[model samples]
Target: MVAADSTMRMEPAWRVLGCRGCGSAIVECALVLAKIPYEREEADYATKEGRDRLVQLNPLAQVPTVILPDGTVMTESAALVLYIGGVAPELGLVPDVRDPLRREFLRWLMFLVAAVYPTFTYGDEPAKWTHDGEEELRRTTDEHRKSLWRLVEGAVRGPWFLGETPSALDLYVSVMTRWRPRREWFAQNCPRLYKIALAVDADPRLAGVWADNFPA
Candidate 1:
């Protein structure tokens, strides 16, 4: 998804505590690309001590906890994107809270989180998807993800989801969908979304995160 040698730079005062290759990590990826001043602290989420401290910030104990210098702490990657974008609305990286697209954005964004991602990222087991077998569940998840990607692929009637400018949603989708190169699996089936990923990846604004622990 990025040039081989690309990198993300951070400034002091912001700390992102999480893994390097998780979805939260991808949000950190976008934050760095936006040139937001911050640093990452990879925490052992599986440990009780780490889990306890993380829950203090986010009751759900989600990864990617952001602690600001002013003692403000927030979790949930999408909400974090909104918070950071709230600080720099001029960047147009986020839609307005009042803007209808903001709702549309979150609706689709969380769908990616609640439905699309977990389905694809979880264990390949029958129990996970209520299917009779692991192979069946895997097939079902893959097909569902493919359909979701296609839905998003068509949602863009304009250059971006909103029509004129690229958004946090754009950044979110790009990083989330960037997986191992599978020309037919993604490039061919999800052409429009794939094309958008390439376009966003090419922007200097986003090039900041091309390096680091992003997926290949």
Candidate 2:
């Protein structure tokens, strides 16, 4: 019943632990849009203790793990966006349940999570997948990821993913373009999506968060 209580602002604080450049940046961006009070703890997934700490909170040992004020833990970037969007409807990050674009919102959000994010999770460091042909695998995955971005570029409707207003979908894509082969490649291959990314990057609501998460 998150949507039912969308207008209510709870007093509890929230803390998310993850690397700034990772998907956790999406969660941080959503929190800023929601105008919710929260803090971030930078965790280095490279170290043993760092990995162990994340595993302790989230069995998956993933970044973007949120510690709710009530001692409850939350995971997954998409779910966090939905939850925070519900908690703060004034921001328009989450569409109304009855709105037709709601379906589109959910679809693109899941698409980013299921398809786009995995590229970095597996492609950026293919050695984690197998030692025999890591180089080839990385190259293949990088190309596949670029192709996926092109598909998304064609799907965008302009100004934002759902059109006119900003949403969690745009923010997700924005942070993602900053990774891997980098934004230059994306700009050339997926011009439309690259524009959406730039718009999200320059959004007034997200301006501060973007600067903090991605410094020049």
Choose the strongest candidate by lDDT.
2
lDDT of 1 at 129: 50
Candidate 2 wrongly placed segments (more than 4 Å): 1-12
Listed in order, each prediction's TM-score against the native is 0.74, 0.90
Q: lDDT (CA) for every model shown?
A: 0.66, 0.81
**Per-residue lDDT of model 1, residues 1-216, tens digit only:** 232223433323577777555566556656665556666666646678777878878776667788876778877777787777877787777777777777777777777677766664553345645655777777777677777777777776457766677777777667666642333466787776776677777776544455555546
Per-residue lDDT for 33-124 in model 2, tens only? 77676777877676787788898899878888999878889999998999998889878898889888899899888888998878778876
Model number with the top TM-score:
2
How high is the lDDT of residue 84 in model 1?
Answer: 77
